[model samples]
Target: MTPEPRSGRPRSSSREVLSEAACELFLEQGYDATSVSDITRRAGVSRSSFFNYFAAKSDVLWSGFDEQVNAAARRLRGGEAVDAALTGIGDGLAPDALALAITNADAMGIAGELDRDRAVRQFRLQRELAARFVRDGMPQLAAEVRAGALAAAVLAAVWAWADRTAAERVLRDLLATTIALA
Candidate 1:
């Protein structure tokens, strides 16, 4: 039988390992030069394992937040209040690969990549939020307006929280402050 890895590490941690490896490689060699194979090699996992967690290379920096955004979308659609649903976006978030990339985009040479990927996520949240508001009896245009502002707030709070030094980070508090904008 193949021996299991030790130290209580779970199969799911492969995602985290791949993200860390990708971030380190991006810093070491820049994003365009660091391929998926490079990340898999550095992370000590197979290419298939890398795909198990991320769809593409740029996904290494966006998956965690994307997961949270999806969770928040589910919560909102399930009749959760807007503030509660939006704030929950930060519930389990920690300083992660995306934060590292944001803070060191210049060194990692991923500024353009960050902007392009982030816009996709921001609008996704906006679309989800707008639908939720419409279900809650908001007029169409007002729902869109409110959702747009709240979506921007959610992204801003996430970005600000990520920008903080890890030692001082508190995501829920930041979420609360930003959610107040809506």
Candidate 2:
């Protein structure tokens, strides 16, 4: 077990451990076959501890990205330019976690199962981003279009990163380019 940080909360290492353990189990036993108990047992953590960090098994794969998205949304709401906001979001990508999931997607049986959930989350993110842009003085339709494009770009970049074809490309750069085109 990791020691608690100064704030008396377990260090972020606990989350990492859970995520790593979940991914390994997903890859080995298949995502459908792995339960929260299995992940907790592998991580040597309590069930409550797992709940403290993740709402569901799939969350182990997306929580980091979701955190980044929320941060970017906050920046957007703070009047940051769309490009800069998207760049911030890209900058938040957890390379190691994402790479692990992408590389083991097939083995984990997550490739097809993720689309619907991902699409829903992406749409919600797009709406929130668009709303922020509108509050920042952009026209509604324009904000919506820009948000949609930026959201799509983020998805594309994740896919590219996972595919390992963008080995030399930085996520922020991809986001910047996509925003520029938008």
Candidate 3:
């Protein structure tokens, strides 16, 4: 017999299972209509297990990217050059997950919300990238400008690729082109 959600410790894979279940439900019934209860039921986990993995429903889409960003930030702090740090960021981009989220954005009833979140995330990332560049010896003003343009390009590339099949290649090519242009 399976243990109840709160009755026993969750498996190590609980977070992935919960995220997958939430994405499935979000694609089916729409994000606005799917509750945490519905997700837990689908995953056969307790409601508390949902909270253990994510702070909120929207986090299902962003958590992987957040982890990547955090990791890139740590690398930057280790004194990596701006170009190298951005390459690390590109390496961590989960194109498949991002494409899935974008495809379901309208169905999930989070088109606007996702856009807002993306903008905010990009703004913060750009600022941090610029700071890191300055720390690596670029002038502050040049660093800021370069980071802004690079961030915009990266976001545009990702958004454009989200609708395309074989998005991983597109993302890679776009990032390579952007870095070359920079």
Top candidate on TM-score is 1
Residue 120 miss distance in model 3 (angstroms): 2.0
RMSD of each: 2.7, 3.7, 3.9
> In candidate 1, what are the lDDT values of residues 93-145, reduced to their tens digit?
77899999988999999999998988888899989988988888889999889
For residue 176, model 1's alpha carbon misses the true position, in angstroms, by 1.3
Q: How far is candidate 2 from the true structure (C-alpha RMSD, Å)?
A: 3.7
Model number with the top lDDT: 1
Q: What TM-score does each of the candidates earn? A: 0.91, 0.86, 0.80
Query: Ranking by lDDT, best first?
Result: 1, 2, 3
Between candidates 2 and 3, the lDDT winner:
2
Cα deviation at 165, candidate 2, in Å, is 7.2
Candidate lDDT values, in order: 0.87, 0.79, 0.74
- lDDT: the better of candidates 1 and 2: 1
Cα displacement (Å) at residue 73, model 3:
0.9
What is the clash count for each candidate, in the order shown? 0, 0, 0
Query: What is the total number of backbone clashes in candidate 2?
Result: 0
Candidate 2: which stretches are off by over 4 Å?
1-9, 137-139, 165-167
lDDT value, residue 128 of candidate 1: 98
Which clashing pairs does model 1 show? none
